[model samples]
Target: MSLVNAANRFLPSDTPAAFVADAQRVAVRGERVITLSMRHAGARQVALRYELVGAADAPVVFVAGGISAHRHLAANADFPEKGWVDDLVGEGRALDPANRRLLSFDFLGADGKLDAPIDTADQADAIAVLLDLLGIEQLHGFVGYSYGALVGLQFAIRHAARLHRLVAVSGAHRAHPYAAAWRALQRRAVALGQLQCAEDHGLALARQFAMLSYRTPEEFGERFDAAPEVVNGRVRVAAEDYLDAAGAQYVSRTPVDAYLRLSESIDLHRVVPSAVAVPTVVVAVEGDRLVPLADLVSLVEGLGPRGSLRVLRSPYGHDAFLKETDRIDAILATALRTTGETA
Candidate 1:
């Protein structure tokens, strides 16, 4: 059988039901996941779905989240609590799925939606696949955080005229040593059978490690400094609670294999500066370890006149894009307005 046939066969017989259940689950949490059927420019007919955050026809802005699978980005998915992107979609936020079509999809993965191969170029092509399906010949803008940022860059490079503006948050044009190192270990962990999928224990631990670098030491120190005072043999501190929440949630929802594949792919990212000429904004978090401030600068500088870099103050590191949703929203709302004019 051909890949497409195999893919269709691999899909659960109850995919329609499963898809509806997933969407409803997100809806209960004030989010929605809409599945879009589209085919790649080639013969590969893909079942693509994106998490919707805003209204339709207001302006289409594609939000790129997980590189592994679309389900991974679901608010109710078995991952750490959904963050900024979720916060932004409510009522009046920038990319409100209720007001504008906010689409976030996953790239092709290695196995049954649980694994993603680092096909950055193909991943970009997949966006075209989605656009074709949505009957959207062009997008008003594109916004991405971290790995999604790289995917957005790829899209802009390959489909420059397709997007009006691009916003890359907490992402780097090139991989840093810290990111590469973690990714290597993650890949090794999966290869050695230490982790089976993105939500596996080993992969969870690996993610926990990566999560540490995504934030700032000072933030942890300040947040945990007071520690939890012993009370009836029970103690709690905001910092400990925060870390536990993030770590526990991620391990529970995300599959180990999917995490490893996506993380590894994110680690190997390298952007062709010249490939991007769209009016772009590279937002760098001050304390981000995964994506250094320098890297954001490089991306902006590389974009020349068409690119501008903005640094935001956040103790949350790379995850700040989610943690600091309100702040990020303000920036995005402003960017969308400005980006249109500039683009």
Candidate 2:
């Protein structure tokens, strides 16, 4: 059955935003009013966007990724063949959609609910509520990358009984000081843009910094040769052209307020790994500068007996999850085996 049919049968919502359906996608809006601080804002209404993929009776596997990532988890008409994990997840692939239904949602603190600064715990709570609303009492497993992985950590801690196995790739339980500093600079750039009545420019500037942090020196050295833009055989700092284009594209679609709220919330998020009862795998990229090796090692040690860590050597740095396919698939293979699909 299509997601629209499934939601109509289970959700029964009449609101337009509650169910935004079309020929290509079935998107749902999870609405709730959060009681915020009276000093600033007493309460705020939030509508989280989500999408479900695969069969009705299949075991559910929750998937989440970066901040900009939305609910398009696979190759649909709207997304063409560029779903975030399009290569790793499919029929006969790791966490095959044919065997396990996939659930994905937009990270809160984005455009939908910019009023409150939420922690990853809030994101986890939203996941629990979404699963309950969907009538999914339990999940076969949970997989998250980057920001999604942090949410997965919070989920494992907050809802230990909800899933059998967990997978977190290229995410840290706690924000690193160095990483926070870089993000702070990015936020600062955005704040400046907000202050100057040029949020679009701010957003683009922030993205430039982000692009650098997301990538590794190896990639730049191999691809761009650390040079400027070369147009018509004219070299004028091409990296600037790339950053400009990237930032411009990001700001064009993303809301400035939402970016500030979500990026700042990430810095405030913290979790006690030892408190996590669910069996978990913490995957780290060796070249990832955004998250320190010490931090990942600490997370594994904190996992106690049921916890283990896998460090994949790659030149992709923090973006390894998107680049190193075979390695990521191998890790997912273990998670699938460990989670023991019930469908």
Candidate 3:
């Protein structure tokens, strides 16, 4: 038997949500893969690919991450050994699937749903659509990391009643100008690179710059700052090889053309923190170069009393949420549940 069942028992048998289209089997994950098809105002027919695991009756929790994230979120199904948010969410870790209904959805441009970038608002709409399909009146919690954090905050503003708790990691109400400037150059690399019809070189070059911002100077100083290797007539270092590998890997798995579009989406995303009312935890990393600590200070203030600001010191920069599992897990064990609920 499943951990929990008969989730439908909580909803009215004749609820209007019953009008939702039946989910069709799309592909294989661990146990379930379904298509949540809906009409996009501008894009015509659109389907959001998703996967679900854990107790049927447990409060549903949605997980959203970077642009490359997929709906396949099972921990043991080998959904990318190094998935960006994989470390923080799993059966034995924070946001454990054993006790919660974990819902992972593809971003708007994913699965060929749309060819270009859509703002975090577009992604938030997708979540609302999925909740309607599942007949979930309210999510136990919504966890968003990096790019997904923007979507989470936007969802709180647009669909406050649909979520009980909000976890925004490395997100701010608006994109920092310094961060936007860096991404602008990265997007230019993608637009200018001519290595293939796909602009493969552009992504590689952009990733080189992204790597610096994703990590902290302390990490580089201790790990690969001085290691050098002969490349052509000159010499290179571990940092160069690392960036090259990261860019190559990213291009191999991600849509080359989608890179700049999504990067721009991050820049264009903005929201008013005071408008969000759901209990929220905004996670900040002291070393995050992309979304600086200064930005988080303003965000916490804007959220006022409803938002809780958590600051962590990590060597991974903005990427700490992916690496600092123990600290994140402890924090989430409290944030995922309400004042009266047990984690």
Q: Pick the candidate with the highest TM-score.
A: 2
My TM-score estimates for the predictions, one after another, are 0.74, 0.84, 0.84
lDDT of 1: 0.63
Question: Where is model 2 more than 4 Å wrong at Cα?
Answer: 1-43, 77-81, 226-235, 338-343
Number of the predicted model whose lDDT against the real structure is largest: 2
Q: Candidate 2: RMSD over Cα atoms?
A: 5.5
Clash pairs, candidate 3, are none
Q: Write one digit per residue (lDDT tens) for candidate 1, span 276-338.
A: 968898899987877889888888888999888888888888778777888888888878873
| Residues 1-343 of candidate 2: C-alpha lDDT, one tens digit per residue | 2222233244323224223322123333344434332212334555555667665556778999877776666674333435666777776667675566678876766653465667888788878877766667887888988888899999999899998888988888799989989999998998898898987888899989999988888887787765456679977874676777888778766777677777877788788889888988989988788986678899999999878899998888888888888789888877766344432
Error of 2 at 229 (Å): 7.2
RMSD of each: 7.9, 5.5, 7.0
Point out where model 3 deviates above 4 Å.
1-44, 77-84, 195-198, 227-230, 338-343
Model 1 Cα shift for residue 292 (angstroms): 0.7
- Shift of residue 225 alpha carbon in model 1, Å: 3.1
Error at 320, model 3, angstroms: 0.3
Clash counts for the predictions, in order: 26, 4, 0
Candidate-wise lDDT, in order:
0.63, 0.74, 0.73
Candidate 1: Cα lDDT at 234: 82
